[model samples]
Target chain A: MSAMNKQILLKSRPNGEPTAANFDLVETPVPTPGAGQFLVKVIYMSLDPYMRGRMGAEKSYAATADLGAPMVGGGVGVVEESNNDQFKVGDYVMCGTGWQSYCLSDGTGVMKLDPKQAPISTGVGVLGMPGLTAYYGLLEIGKPKAGETVVVAAASGAVGSVVGQIAKIKGCRAVGIAGSPDKCAFVVEELGFDVCLNYKDADFPEQLAKACPDGIDVYFENVGGKVFEAVLPLFNDDARMPLCGLISQYNMTELPKGTNMLPALMRAMLTHRILIQGFIISYHFNHLPAFLKDVSGWIKSGQLKYREDIVEGIENAPEAFMGLLKGKNFGKLLVRVADDPTRN
Target chain B: MSAMNKQILLKSRPNGEPTAANFDLVETPVPTPGAGQFLVKVIYMSLDPYMRGRMGAEKSYAATADLGAPMVGGGVGVVEESNNDQFKVGDYVMCGTGWQSYCLSDGTGVMKLDPKQAPISTGVGVLGMPGLTAYYGLLEIGKPKAGETVVVAAASGAVGSVVGQIAKIKGCRAVGIAGSPDKCAFVVEELGFDVCLNYKDADFPEQLAKACPDGIDVYFENVGGKVFEAVLPLFNDDARMPLCGLISQYNMTELPKGTNMLPALMRAMLTHRILIQGFIISYHFNHLPAFLKDVSGWIKSGQLKYREDIVEGIENAPEAFMGLLKGKNFGKLLVRVADDPTRN
Candidate 1:
């Protein structure tokens, strides 16, 4: 084990689009655990679009990341040292370890993980917040009935991939929208989505309309820009939209220059009786147990599939995170901060 | 009752805003009730925002109004002659009688009303569809908890008045927005809202924010142009919005010119985890019994109040309906097609 801990700190708020200069990587001597505290060696750190919202001083559903502090995020780690009675050394756990190699925990929200059941990295991926988010949002808000057409954006990403798989399991036609042709292929061939459209295509809206002949009943909204505009007109009466993220608009520092389409959207909503709900997964932790059981069962039965885009080292997190905003990562983007002992 | 049936029919779809040229008033000899049908002398006809959507060729939640048919609307009336077993002679009933002095009905979607319990005009106003809309949308979608701030637009209108009153009954701080000072006064003093703001005021947005100091927990959206713009920034975390009507945008022929604020609204929704849902009351008639019981009790106990803007004669129906879109009506806009026998 390394004697020194490497931490990525939020140096400044991003100006429009984020750059590597917004974060600072610093090293400090690893500290010993206090009386009831434990030290966790972070194996895999999550890089999500939501973290971008946290970088701004504006109040989000979750608290903003403080400048000069470790960038706020969740990670799966190993309890290397423990004085706490509940958590012990060698126990694998999931906690908000942020962008760091190691973090001290008193076990406020730490969940003990079993490496024998699945890959330890999945504790931060399919078996973690992203999977739970997709499960709750799709079932609770989207309410995709059997034979309904369920459309989800960011098709090959963490949450959307699970959303489409869950839709298929629930006996619905899952339509996916992705940035590239490769991701589109992955969503269809690998993830079992009924149809996957490349949103980058010039005739993407036309393709989307052709793909959804019955109209979209459930739209799992993650990317909200031109993508949302395309999905807007094709909504069936009583359409349900479970909105969790707007990756396309995250870097936008200004409102788009165009005729205000707010009224048009509102009119369509009324015409179709559409229901749009935004949610942050942190507020829904109570749903985690049910999600874990259902998702774990599905994963075990091969009804659900997940992919991890693993980037190596804490130093690469900034560039990878920036790339994530532009849809560069192919799947659940995770930074492998340290060697996974469970893998050996 | 009149010997001749006087009807106002839709002549043409409005280009931008509607005018008298859009409708035609025609007189025909009163037709006899056929087998299993009854003749109704229409007394009060409802002029609602939803009817505007029906006038357009573009599909709405409900079907578009036929070009030469009597303008589609609900009305309270008396059964003058009856061959139907269910509807007796001299019984007051509510049905889609449209803008006509007399009509023949086969008893579908008709609800009998008793003037002894309350005014029969309320069958199309406070005790009918408008009341039920407010009840279900507020309780089911808004889900106003005790001490929550509930803001409703078109405060003096049928649906909005009931929304504010129900919000108060649920122990919420009810804030209302209306078009004029008198309407605002009626909303606060007569309808018992905590505060009411005139949307026409230059500082109305500021006033709304000040009124909802704790932030709006539930916003009952009926007037969805400028009123919605004001309510957008003041939403609390996990705010609920039940969107039933968008009166301000109903007559819009083209998109408004400005920087598109859709992204800003989406961002706010995500930041606060807001839920915005649109509903058509027709789909929710199954909940009519519960809504009728609760709202009737509230009205009987004086906890809920309602006002009607009655324009006499079928000739004035087009003008009154035109005035409604401009917020010229003081309360629930109703056109009196025939004299009410119950009132006499």
Candidate 2:
């Protein structure tokens, strides 16, 4: 292994949309692991929309990433050296590797992964945080029932894809909304969604209304700008929404200007008995065991599918994440920091 | 018995706040009950905030009150005549009596009330709809835990009074908000709330903050304008909101002009994992039996107390209802259409 570890750090907070100039790519001497610690050589680092919130100095659900420090994230990697009895050399694991090629861990949240069981990259993709997020948010909060209609936006993305497939597994009519016709087709055809609508179309709202002939029962709220505005009016009485993320609004510098519509929104919610619950997966880790088992089984049985859009280097993370905010990435956006030994 | 049946009929739908000019008082020839029917002489008519929603021709959770039809409401009255086996002469019962001196019923939704057991007027107040609303919206939706803080608006009124008392019963710190100092005192002294803030005061928000040292865990949303604006900022992580009514917005002619705060609100909801569930009490009839049992027990044990604001005469119901929308009534607003024989 090289003596230098390449890491991406947050240089400054963005006023609105993030730019590459706001991040710093640096190479630092790899630190040796201390007593009861291990070193993991990162293979894949996850780039999620949630990271944008952490970049800001404001108080947030997740801890803010300190400026000039490694941007916080999770990754799948192989243990290169270990002093801890639980983790051994040559063993693959998933831990908080951040936006770095090499990281030191004391195994607090480290989970040993059997690369032979599934593709190693999946530890940072479908079988990891995103998958668990989809599982808990959809089943626990969304509570989709049989014959009910479940709608999710960013349908081709990691969380939305899993949410829709799980809706189908639960006997619901799963409807997806994506930015492009291609992504929409992939969601409907490959992922087995009942229908997928391209939200970019001029008559997208009308199309959504037509797609959901029966009003939406469970709306997995992922991208919440125009998509939510469209779904708000079409909600069935007693609708459940698991508010996971608002990707469309994350880059906003300030609130939009218009007629204050909260009263109207509250009215709609009350009249329909809609339940909107915001959840962070970390707080709901108690659901991890069931989520892993069910999601793994679904993947094996062809009831679920995942797609990855892997960017090549850690230095490219800032651009890839910026693209993610603009709906530029096709699927689960990941930064491949090093070669996966199991892949070859 | 009077030879004529007097009823208040909807003359027209009001644009915002209801007016006396929108209703007509008419006398119809007293109709004799046909087979399987009974005649009821309304004694205590319930005047509730939810009535305003039905008065509109727009789509709402409630059925629209047709022009020239008697405004819909529940009432406690005596069965004057009966062709139905379920009812007999001089038997007090609670049923849909509308705004009328006399009503004909076929026994559906009619609950026989015993004047000997409790005050018959309670069928529309504490032991009835408003009481059940507080019980269900608090225990079921709010789910307050011991030592947690629960906040409610319109604290001296029907639902809010019950909500705070129930929070106390569950070992929670109850904080209340009311429009007047007298109402605030009544909420604190009479209803056993830990604290009550008069919202009309200039430093009301600061007073609310001081009242709740711990952040709010459950917010029983009743009035939604300024009161809601005050409560929204103090919600703790994992706060649960039971949206029972938005009485403040009912008389709004149009949405207020300002910067759209929905994004900021959504961010707050997400960061705190808040659960805002809007509900209409009518659909949850399954919870009624449990509500009646618990609330009755609490009232009998002196753990819960109730007050009624009674306005005499059926002709005054329109004005009473309008006053209710403006928060003019101090307690469970009710129109006493005739003498409550049970009272004397």
Candidate 3:
């Protein structure tokens, strides 16, 4: 291991869309573990749209990330040294190591990863935060019943992909909306979605309506904006909407210009008896055990499939994240910080 | 008995706010009851805000009122003639007699009304549709917890008044919003709400915020224009919203001008993990038995108080309904079409 640790710190908040200048890559001395603490060599760092909210000074569901400090995130890491009995050297673990190459933790919220069970990178990917987000948001909030039509936006991305797959497993007609035709094809073919439509199509609304002939019963809201507008009129009576994220609006600086259509939206919701709820996965930690068991079984039986969009080097996280906001990444966006021993 | 049956027919659909010209007073030859059918002499008719939605040609949760047909509503009447084994002369019953002097029914949805139990008018007021709407919307959807602040709009109207009273029953701090000072006073003093703010006041939002020192935990949305704007910023984490009606926007012909603030609204709902669900009371008929028992008990113990805005004569129903849209009625609006034998 190197004596220097590379860290990406939030230099400033962005007014609208973020740029690389907002983040500063710095090198510091490798952190040492203290009593009951452990040092982790971060191997894979996750770059999610949620990190953009944390970078701002405004109070969100989660606390804001302090400027000039390492950006907050989760990662899969190798335990280099441990002062705690629960973790040992050479063991892999999932930790909130943020956007850093090396970090020190006191074992709180740290879960040891078993490499023999699944891939180590999955601790921060399909079998981790994104997977659990899809599990709870789709099952608990959306509650897709058998043979019901379930629609999800950002269909080829991390969370939406899992949501659609789970909907299918629950005997639903899973439909997906993606940015590109190729991604749509991948979602329908590889992910086993009933249908996948490219939201960028000129006839997106018509296409979405045609895809959901019986109307949408469960709408997994991931990317709001034009995509949401397409799904609104197709909602069936008693539809359930699990509002997970609005990635399309995350980078918006101000309220968009146009008529205040909230009245119309509320009317549609009321007329259909739709249940729209926003949820954060961290608030539902009690669901994690069931999520892990079911998802692991699905993966083992080849009932679940996942794709990763890996960007090598911690220094490239900002660019990769900016691409993620623009739908530039193909699947789950991640920053590879170090070489994986189990891979070779 | 009169040889003619008087009816209020829908003359035409209104563009924005309905006018008296939209209704026509018509008389038809009285028809005799068939076998297994009974004739009901309508006495007291209920006029609710939801009736406005039915007037429109557009499809809402309920079916639209047919053109040139008697306006749809609920009423209590005396069975003047009966050929059915279940009903006899002089028996009071609740039926969907609409806006008419007489209606014939075979008891599909008709319920026998005992004048000895409670006022027959209550079949549509505090002990009937409006009361059950409050009970189910507040308890089932709003889920108000003790010490939590619950805010209800159109505070002095049929649904809102009951919602505020029930919130008090559940040990929640109930804040109400009405259109005038008198209505606000009634909501606080008569309805037993913790506080009531007049939305017509210049500093309405400030007053609302002051009333709810603790952020709003549940918002029973009845009026949905300016009142909703004020409540949006005061929502606490895990807030629940029972979206019953948008009475304020029911008369709107077009979407309001200005910034499309849905993004901001979605952001608030997401940050708070708010659950906003729209529901129709008729869909929850199973709750009626419990609702009747609890509300009857409350009325007997003086824990529940009710006020009725009674307008005499069926000819005045059009003007009274228009007044209701403008928040002119003091309490539950009712049209005493004929003599209420149970009253004296």
Could you list the chain B TM-scores for each candidate? Answer: 0.98, 0.98, 0.98
Residues A216-299, model 3: lDDT tens digits: 999998788888888989899999999978999988988898888688789989999999999998899899899999999999
Q: Tens digit of lDDT per residue, candidate 1, span B157-188?
A: 98999999999999999999988889888888
Residue pairs in clash, model 1: none
Better structure of 1 and 2 per DockQ = 1
How should the candidates be ordered by lDDT, best one leading?
Answer: 1, 3, 2
In order of appearance, the predictions have TM-scores of: 0.98, 0.98, 0.99
- The lDDT values for all models are 0.92, 0.90, 0.91
Tell me how far candidate 1 lies from the true structure as C-alpha RMSD in angstroms. Answer: 1.3
lDDT of 1 by residue, A60-121 (tens): 77889999999999999999999999999999999999899999999999999999989988
Ranking of candidates on DockQ, top first: 3, 1, 2
**Candidate 2 per-residue lDDT over residues B1-344, each given as its tens digit:** 65688899999999998998999999997778899999999899999999898899887888888899998999999998999987999999999998888999999989888887689999988888898899999999999999999999899999999999999999999998888889988998999999899898998888888888888999999888778887878889999999989999998889888887677778889999999999988878799889888988888899999989999888888988999998999999888888988897
Error of 2 at A196 (Å): 1.7
Better of 2 and 3 by lDDT: 3
User: Model 3, B107-184: lDDT tens per residue?
Assistant: 888888888889999888988889899999999999999999999998888888889888999899999899888988
Docking class of 2: high
